[model samples]
Target: MDESSVRKMSPRRAAELLSKTPGEELSLQAWEGLREVCVSGMQDERLSADERIGWAAAGALVVDRMRDHSECADRRVAMASEARLRAYVITRFGREDDSSLRDLSLLIRRVVDAVGAESWVVADSADGWQRMTRHEMLELRRIKNLVTPFKSILPLLSPTDPLRDKIKEWVDIIPLLP
Candidate 1:
């Protein structure tokens, strides 16, 4: 599909297309379309919260797939995708709520693992454990703070949750103090 065709699609329809399309044939156009749909869905006031969350989650998954396939070849695109995922979490769940904290921690850790510090340094010249963008620093702090509350309840979280593994990696890379 072309950019124009994808842009005209509704969020639900875009997500449908994304889900239906074979992974090998998934084009940049389709990805952009889904991203646009998510962006527009978040901005639309008429959509229900559940609908918006669905779109946002779909968008994040698309980015995650992109990262896995592309191997962070395009640093700018990777960074933008991660940022959009974070924005979706913030927009959907708010910044400081329990849900937001948990979800945002997951999102941040996903970026750290998927994109890696090398990609981030290449993309923004953010040295590992030294100079980071304010946003990156904030995300690290948020992940730490959020994970603290879940340590005792960790068994309740799904075993498949990446947080169980990625939190240790985040701690090793992200400086404890900004």
Candidate 2:
């Protein structure tokens, strides 16, 4: 499909198309189309809650695909996708009473691991560290607020569940945030 058509497509239809596309490997065009559909869906305020969730799921799927196919040579794009997915989750669900928090935590961990210290560096200057610290502080506040209610139940997760570790790690690190 052309860019214009993809731009005008409904989130449901875009998700349907993405679902049909083989996951073994995605062509550049296919990936771009899916990305556009997801961004459009997220930005379009007329969509119902269900539609927005579907679009967010689509964005999550893209993040998962990027993680699985790490050699896709689009690290920056994947980072942006993950950031958008995280923001969508935070905006849609302010608490961690559901599985969406698990997804968001995992995405944040993945981005942190993939980008390393670079993710914390927003610019190249002595003052950049201050800006980065402010951003980290805000993220820490959001994460703490979202995960505190679920803290008691997090340990009950199976040892094999990666989110258990990720959440614990975040909880442990939040205390040291400046």
Candidate 3:
């Protein structure tokens, strides 16, 4: 959606748009609707974008995890899920501004949707990743940066191409590997 459309949205409306069609373009209209409501409840101006995106990302992550665990099917669940998704984005990126948060959330959601798989299915960090502190994210980023390129590992992992098949697969939590 364009800037004008974005300017007119409510958060609830934005959430519905995402749920109805998960991979829509970067609809600035939708982000504004949600951010308008969410940003006001926050504190630091510097963190506002981070908070918004963090809420959305964390909420989305939690919601995706709850798909089979929770039975709620109402709009309420959607609202809560959006909140969680925003939280995750904040936690990951350390920002909490309206525009930054919503932009990151939409971008992440779109990327996940485009791949036609849950985000976890694509790049789930190890079990400890969810609990990572700000220091940890920075450390991990640095560690990743310092690593030298490898011509190959013993055996390069065959990346799972999600689009080649239509069957939805579930992660077997017990196995520690999906």
Candidate 4:
């Protein structure tokens, strides 16, 4: 889809466009469009959390598909995409029906894998982890202590859940980050 076309896209349309469009074919404008759509979708209370996550996952896949491609070489943008994906997984996870739990698990895996050596800035609050903007979270870290959001998600997963192991592995790796 073109930039203007994507800008006008609804969550469902954006998801469908992202799913079918190859990463290499996506212009930077398209990337921005996906980001815009994902952000707006998150704020749209009319949509269920599961639906928001579905749209977020679709946007995240662009980065995953272009991981080694030059189009995704912009680290700042990639990190933002990763943060958006992580925010959805951390905040909306387990809030939906059990049928979608598996989907969330897969999205979590993808988000974690996409994170690799990147440092994620997130804030925890009574309103939940998704309430803060990335800039706000970054500012708070400059002025106060913060915790890795992944560690808090462990208690939400069952011990027998396969996703628990992946999350545990991710949590174990966090402290090792500089």
Candidate 5:
């Protein structure tokens, strides 16, 4: 479909398109609508688990497209998409099948890219907080909030798994933040 048509599409229709369409095929406006659908879908308690997974998958696609078109995509949209996708995966970690595990790994990598070495660098030291702007502190807090849920999911992963280690690292550092 054309950009104009996608812009005019309803949320339900946009979600349908999201499930079936590639992110590169849709305009950013369409992605906005898709993002709306995903955020709501993930939050809606009445939706079946499978349905939420579908929304999470679509959100992942949006993040992937944003990564590919980093220059063209809005940073806000990419960051929000990554945040939502990561939350969904981490919340549902133990329940996911093998394929979702693969998706989770990719999502983790994207998050690492988004947050960069900030996770390692902060350590929530007094000096780190002194050096950062208010905006930077809030962004780290946002990331901390996102990963805090991993504390519950951590036990589900094997001790030897690198993802488990990453989650442990995040859960460990976040509490040190003010």
Candidate 6:
């Protein structure tokens, strides 16, 4: 049969046929379930930022996740295949051409360079680390020592420039695809 006809088959009927037939498309049917779960999770609006990170951290390619995770809601992994993941990085993110692994590596380098070597980090207990804007960090630092400090404590610097090596320790963003 053709793609559409097979897609329309009930899961039970498809499985029995696969057992009787040679090279039956059980894989495609399985993937359909996975894809549905992934699409549903992607559509969930109630996920928190950390929860979103958890989703990103699943590390499955959209195609794989769409295929496999749609099968089960609880077990979805982020982009599971490198080839598909690389394709997504190029297509969805800024890299249009030269989406090769090496090209992606280069883009990461450029981004790191643009951010500069020195900076202030603001950490939220639940929200993870954020590097404050230069102006905000400065005003916090300058006024922190003067006057009866009230709410500026959160804003002011503790005089730290979390080392470049430490910054490098950030969870590998490239791995998000596969």
Candidate order, lDDT descending: 5, 2, 4, 1, 3, 6
Q: What does candidate 5 score on TM? A: 0.59
Candidate 2: tens digits of C-alpha lDDT, residues 1-178: 4456656666667666656655546765566566666766765678886677677766666555664563556454566556556655555544353556235555555555544433124222223234566656554444334334334434555789665675565445434433
Compose the digit string of candidate 6's lDDT tens values, residues 1-178: 3334433544334334433432223454544443344333333457553333223223233233333433433221222232223323333332322533324444334333333322222122112213556655443332221111112121221337322233333222212111
Task: Provide the lDDT at 4 for model 1.
Answer: 60
lDDT digits (tens) for residues 1-178 of candidate 1: 5446655666567667766655446665566565666666655668776666666755765665555454345544544565555644564455442544226565555555544454234323324535677787655444344323323333433668655554444334334434
What lDDT tens digits, residue by residue, belong to model 4 across residues 20-46? 777677666566666666666665678
Error of 6 at 152 (Å): 37
In candidate 4, stretches whose alpha carbon ends up further than 4 angstroms from where it belongs are: 1-4, 64-69, 74-87, 93-149, 159-166
- Candidate 2 segments whose C-alpha is farther than 4 A from its true place: 1-13, 23-26, 66-71, 74-76, 101-104, 117-178
Pitting candidate 2 against candidate 5, the one with the higher lDDT is: 5
lDDT of candidates 1 onward, in order: 0.52, 0.54, 0.36, 0.54, 0.60, 0.32
Candidate 3: misplaced stretches above 4 Å?
24-139, 142-178
lDDT of 3 at 131: 71
Model 4 residue-pair collision total:
0
Better of 1 and 3 by lDDT: 1
Model 4, residue 52: what's the lDDT?
A: 67
| Candidate with the larger lDDT of 1 and 6 | 1
Residue-level lDDT of model 5, residues 69-143, one tens digit each, is 535533544664565566555666334335462355655565566665656675744246647788776766656
TM-scores for all candidates? 0.49, 0.50, 0.22, 0.52, 0.59, 0.22
